[model samples]
Target: MADGRVERGNQTRRAVLARTVDIASVDGLEGLSLGKIATDLGLSKSGVFALFGSKEDLQIATVRAARAVFVERVVQPVQDEPAGLAKVWRLCESWLGYSGRRVFPGGCFFYSVSAEFDSRPGPVHDEIARIRGDWARYIERLLDEARLAGGFREAADPADVRQLAFEVMAMMELANAHSVLHGEAMDYERAARGILTRLRAATAAPEELPERPPAFDFTAGRPSA
Candidate 1:
């Protein structure tokens, strides 16, 4: 009987965090309120407060929950792939898909919330910065792996790899912004093309890179693969 009660409590907490992440993505973490979330979820405000204790605790939990979603959608999908240029490429594509698919109504949760808290000093800011740093290091590690596999040109430097990762990230964010503003999917195609072109240039064996269609056909209501 005690185990059942614990399981139910865990489920309620998960549900709360799921809704909290979506709300935080759209309105920024500063906008979150336990009463508002409780009302939205049709639960008692006191119950929600019991779960999180405070708004800051709720925000922290929301960030952690969103990070778990990110890992499941972007990182785990490509984890088993050959760890080299192909795996790196898969990571980029997965990220694009995650944003384009609207995993969060406001788009990339981290991207949206990071901008909100970047200049502020607090536990929330520190946590978001740590998440961003971890992602950057993951990209760098993938690039290093590709270099070790001889996929990149001998002239490629570690610094160059870092720059490329930054460029790819920029393209992803740009696409997210444009798509959200204009409601157009073509932005993703443009981003993908830019990433593919950059990767091809650095590739030691360009032929090993995935083939793209001759042109993107937006009239068909879907971009060419």
Candidate 2:
């Protein structure tokens, strides 16, 4: 039946997307190829081509797939946290764990791929830009939540807090790149502690600094709403 065919096609599409994200993370989108994907997954060349008519389509699908995995692994976990300084810390912690555990094998997929595609222009590049914008907006929203919670001073601009969030994320990505290249893990831990130090300085009153934990357990599930 045509319906059966459609269902089977959808299954194959999902499988392809799963593999695509992992492969593209390490190899870059341009390095993604039908032959390689098919060979890795043990699928026929025609079958892979049937799901994605061209390489570009496969690349786009890979980005979409990576987005899904990212949300499940990172965003969804922190979505229900009460928005404030706590939520901002939750976001940073989640990202560190996401990278620490090697969720993408090659590290943060967006961080790795975005740099690879930054100067390039196309639908793929557009999608990367959109993802980055979404993340920045989310950080800004967290800063707004902090202001609403009185966690931040009234004079603090949400825009400025968002920029600070980006700096922390950049440090993590830089550490990830170096760690992956050198097989070292200490930088990841240092990056996390450095972020916490900056956040404490930002949020704490002159005499109300928080104590540092020996190790942050970023792997914990999101706090229930």
- The candidate maximizing lDDT is 1
TM-score of model number 2: 0.88
Give per-model TM-scores.
0.92, 0.88
C-alpha-based local distance difference test score of model 2: 0.78
- Cα RMSDs of all predictions? 2.7, 3.5
Top candidate when judged by TM-score against the true structure: 1
Judge candidate 1 against the unseen true structure and give its global Cα lDDT, from 0 to 1.
Answer: 0.84
lDDT digits (tens) for residues 91-169 of candidate 2? 7767777876678878889988998999999999999889888887877788777766677634677677777877877
Query: Model 2, residue 176: displacement in angstroms?
Result: 1.7
Q: Which whole-number lDDT from 0 to 100 does residue 125 have in model 1?
A: 93
Residue-wise C-alpha lDDT for candidate 1, range 13-52, written one tens digit per residue: 9989999888888898988999888899899999999999
